[model samples]
Target: MSDITIRHNPDRERFEVLDAGNVIGKAAYKEYDGGASPQRIFYHTVINEEYGGQGLAGKLATVALDETVAAGIAIVPVCPFIKKFLTKHPEYSANTAATTPAHPEFLNEPSPRARA
Candidate 1:
């Protein structure tokens, strides 16, 4: 993990984790207005099989949430990993939002995936 780097790719609407310049995994999400604050609803996360068993996913989650807060955005942890991570890190509680039925519905609407 010496060469690991986490980069945010907004056009693709995800944060990517690269090891030595190759993408090893990603945490994907969709963002929209969440009333109190704009929200990044993380719905899926995966670390390439070969890269599993390490703590890369946690590292990715850390940076992703850090950046989300830096950008003045709130995190909606629909993804299990993200949800679990938040539970362990209560410091982020203030920046997190609980999921609502409409959050999932928004993900299904046509416009969210139009950029892909």
Candidate 2:
């Protein structure tokens, strides 16, 4: 497999993961400044089905969360995938908004859309 590179495209409000120059996955987010601090809500993540089960999703999550931390922006993980990833990686918790729950149980709860 070719090396995968993750790049943040603020104009698109998402992070693109490219494999050998071709986009294979993307993590979409929305920026908000209505809170105490600027934050990004990671609302969706998707990878080409062909790229599934290869850990590409985890890699994309890592890059996206790392960039959010570096920019001092809190993260609201509305996407179950991202929430689950963060649950396993507590180091990224510091970058989450104060209102975000700290327990994995809360993070793992299914969203309304998922429940339906």
Give me the candidate number with maximum lDDT: 1
Residue lDDT tens for model 2, 1-116: 68778899887789998999988889998776657888888878999998889888998999899989999999988888998998999998778874454333444556455689
Q: Per-residue lDDT for 1-116 in model 1, tens only?
A: 56888999898889999989998899998887957779999999989998888899998999899999999999999999999999999999999988999999888888735667
TM-score of each: 0.91, 0.81
Question: lDDT score, residue 87, model 1?
Answer: 94
What TM-score should be assigned to candidate 2? Answer: 0.81
lDDT of model 1 at residue 19? 88
When summed lDDT is taken over every stretch of 10 residues in candidate 1, the lowest stretch is 107-116
